[model samples]
Target chain A: MIDSINPTAKTVGMLIGSIALGFTFHWQLNVLLSLVCLLFLMTSKRAKLSTMVRVLIPIAFISVSYFMTGWLFSSEQALFSLTNETIVAGGRAELINGLNLGTRILAFGMIGISYSLTTDSYDLIVSFIQQAKMPMKVGYAILTAFNLTSLIQTEYEHSKLAIQVRNLPVKGFDTKPLFTMMVRMVRWSERLSLSMEAKGFSEERTMHRQLKIKRRDIAFAAGFPLVILGLGMILAR
Target chain B: MNKKELTLRDYLLMALISVVFGVFYLLAVYAGTALTTVLTPFGLGVLGYEPFYGIWFMAAIITTYLIRKPVVGIVTEMIAALIEVLLGNMFGVIILISAFIQGLGVEVAFAFTGYKKYTYKVTMTSAVTATVLTFIWTGFRNNYLAMDWRIVLAIFVTRLLSSLFFTGYLSKLICDKLDEAGILNSMQTREVHDR
Candidate 1:
């Protein structure tokens, strides 16, 4: 169901919702928002459990960091003392602030994962070209580059092997191989552009893959943000 | 037609480079998360995470340097942000707004040079401008105003220095290497002749 929705609408909705959620400082509201986002992800048959787990790992780390740091550094006045003496400074207020930021981050992550896991790359590019009115020249270039992912991976492995054979020190963050790979990729991209021109690719031509906004797309585009807003308001009180 | 306008080749090159840097950005995000986590207990989380902030702007600077077209920095960074979103970035769609702001900042720096200089000095200037703009924007967006001024200042300084190193110095080094390897001669020569 999610896969059938228009990628552009889903992305725009997510962008609006996430930005709105980012500004709020209420932990309870953000937590509720995150739980709703998670529930949506869980219900989406297209959203893989493994992908959700992968996305959640980083959010988990981020949330912990936000909670700890916000509690320590937030300027909010202490709501209570940590010990018999006010040794630690920030108290309940800081904790709430921290949790708010942490859960907001989690909510953002879940929304991103849901969209990416379900949306096809070709559909996304098409939607941008058709719905967003991105320049065809720019859109096609991105599509070409996106299609080169496997080739890039192969080149990376080859470069790594070549480095080993050349006895280059495989030390920390060696950028030589990366730069060499980039140079090669740059050359390839130039060739790709030339070949595309040779094949008569033009901006004036319309894309064959037509992007259509279905009923589900409209429903998701309008419904998701409203749900988030409603949940945030209800939970804030 | 303006000869300096970006051609199809320029777009392809920018997109390819942005795709490569998109991978690097993802790795940096993970490293940044870990570093932030480790430093949070010490109350230096913001400062500790500052160094990775500049990495995000590298693609824009490098793309601008390579293409030398007006607004290529912004376009390249936007494409990179798009690729990141497609890769399921933890920050999601917010990356798009951040990228646009950072790209605009770089574009401003290049414009200050009259779009003529691709020197180390200009690169550093662009990095500084981008970092400062992004810092201010994020400060407001992330509620950094609620933090103590001392911590905010610390983060600002650290972020500035990191941008200098990553986007300015390191990018220049890479460009120099590409130049030495003769990979950039065609573009530079064309640019010089155009000028």
Candidate 2:
């Protein structure tokens, strides 16, 4: 179900859910969304277990860090004082605030994982160009650069080898190789663009893959957030 | 210098710049996350990412200064975010929002300089603008308002310094190197010859 939905729709739906998640600090909502996103990913089986575990480990640490920060430095002491709440209640509010911060990270991380793990890069760009009205030039440039990533890595390695061959001190953060690669990049970009123009690449061309908005897209886009909102309201105490 | 139009070459250059920095941003994110874990017990985890905040804006600064065009900062930032998403960033869609806001801030700062001054001061100003805008956004998204003012102040200050060094000073240094290598000149010459 997750994989078959349009990439753009998944992106739009997740983005809406995230923005809505930003406006409040309700721990319940955060936890619910996080759990739902995790379940969604698990059921899809698109993400490998090892990858999920690796990503979640860092996320869990970061979320715990956020929890500690929120607990230690909450600015709501005035509210606790003015309301005349008991110390225990005040402590509970701080705990809730911290939990909210912690779980918010989990929710966001899960949402991001779901979108990235399931969506293909080429498909996403196609969706952007065809369904989202992105300019052809921008879309193609991105696609080209995306293709160049591996080449870029290879070039960097070659530069590093060249430096080692020259018997120069190779630091981890040396900029010489980076600058050399960048010069090559300038040349490559120019040649690529020229070749593209020579091949009569223009905006008035047909796409081989025409990504369209389907019923599933609409259902996911609208229903994802609505379900979250509806659940939040139902769970509101 | 009627070279205001963004040609395909310019877009491709922006794409390349974003791709390079996108990789760097991921490294920074990992480093920062590790640091955050180490510092969580001290309630200073928010400060962990501050040191890398400058790297986040490097693409925007370099693109604007090198391209010297309107909206290059914002566009490059957006492209960087897109690439990161494609590279499987765990922050997800919120990063897109940060990209827009940070890019807008960089654009506004350079716009203040009329896009003509590529000085250290100008880059620093651009970095500052981006830092403040993104900090405010983070404040809301990360619930900084709920944190103590002292911690908030500390995070802001560290971020400001990081931006000044990494985004402003380092990007200017890189651009200077590029200029010295005559790479930028080649770009301009090609554009002029094409016309």
Candidate 3:
């Protein structure tokens, strides 16, 4: 409820953080961004270590798969052969490979965790639209999406239990039933959207936020480019 | 049969399942190489299910299973795959192609059944569909033929089982659970196999 207030700082922080770490895949850059995320997690009273851990588990898998796939796919120069004729795959360590995809994911996850921790979804969207010049339509759409994340979680749990209690052998997926469910869900969202429209709840939101681009906001936004530049230089050297 | 419209609750359930499964997928990958590949095949075997081919099997069947709308599953899966691509992976363009082809495969399963029924058989059918489409992708990527055909066949079978067990059955279980909990509207429940 209180999330209806200021959420600009955290959103801004997330933006700054992701841009710094999202794309380029250098171990040094990843280490740096990860450390920054760690720093925020450690210092931000709002941040929860458990939630961060939850997000990290997937990131870890994704990155490893990236690496493992590289290993399996390698037909390049051999580093050193074992007693067997199997030679080392030299092309595996390209830092920017998919395995190191943790950068954007880390950025997104950190941003998500940081946002959830620091501010409620309400404030986050409002601040984005009103303060940051993010279009009100996009802001509200995202806000609504975020707001319902928990609801989605609950409903899923509910359906699972119902299936179990029915004494049905609800174990494997059939293309038939799964599709049936998705169609149902989309319909509901549409109805809800329709209801919102009927109530004159339009995407025509005109709430202009009043956050000034403070010195800190400017500095924060500028920081990522400079860091990327510095890292770029370091890598070149 | 007509495609049913789901409530927010339905989407949330699917999203939650995706999230948890994603976490589990990560664990599987970690288990694969982090002393896991050495253990059971299940631990890190998912590592083989990279952003490319595996997603097709996953998204096709998954989206198909959850939405029941023929192309929706494929399309949503494609969107999800695009999201992954935006995040970047080893096979960039390949991911998009797999999504399209895989979506086509899932769509085919629905088509074969005439979209007339939703049952475990169809799920398995689509699971196989996903496997076959993915086989083509693997063949294209040279992942299939490069390894021994026997080993490749073994991988395909393992993926088939995983799809059946995890992607196929689990999706239905989770959906049914959500449906009964009153979280899913009675209407949504009515669209599929009624309990």
Winning model by TM-score = 2
Residue runs of model 1 more than 4 Å from their true location after superposition: A77-90, A214-219, A226-237, B1-3, B46-48, B188-195
Off by over 4 Å in 3: A1-26, A57-120, A127-141, A157-167, A172-177, A206-212, B1-195
Candidate 1 lDDT over residue span A53-129, tens digit each: 88788777766766666667775332332232234443556665566556655666667667777777788888998
lDDT minimum window of 10 residues, candidate 2 chain B? B1-10
- For model 3, how does the per-residue alpha-carbon lDDT over A1-237 read when each residue is reduced to its tens digit? 112224564444444444444334354566566566566556765545775576566555544543443334322221122112333244434323323333443444444444455444454446656676754434443344444545654655555566667775544332333333454555555565556556665446455445445666555556645676568567544
Better of 1 and 2 by DockQ: 2
DockQ for the candidate 1 complex? 0.53
**Global lDDT of each model?**
0.75, 0.81, 0.48
Best candidate (score: lDDT): 2
What's the TM-score of every candidate structure?
0.88, 0.93, 0.49
- Best-to-worst order by TM-score is 2, 1, 3
Per-residue C-alpha lDDT of model 3 across residues B1-195, encoded as one tens digit per residue: 445553333343333333323323344544444542332233233335432224235544544544555465555444444333322222322354566766676677677876766577776677777778776765544323222244456567766776677545655565556555554464456444432
TM-score of chain A of each: 0.83, 0.87, 0.61
Question: Taking the true A–B contacts (Cα pairs closer than 8 Å), what share appears in each candidate?
Answer: 0.54, 0.66, 0.00
Worst ten-residue run, lDDT, model 2 chain A? A78-87
The candidate with the higher TM-score, 1 or 3, is 1
lDDT of 2 by residue, A1-237 (tens): 588788888889988878777775567888878888887778775777887787788888888988888877777752363235334554676776677788887888888888877788899999998888888888899989888888777777798899989998766556677677777777888898999999998888678887888998999999888877776666553
2 or 3, greater by TM-score: 2
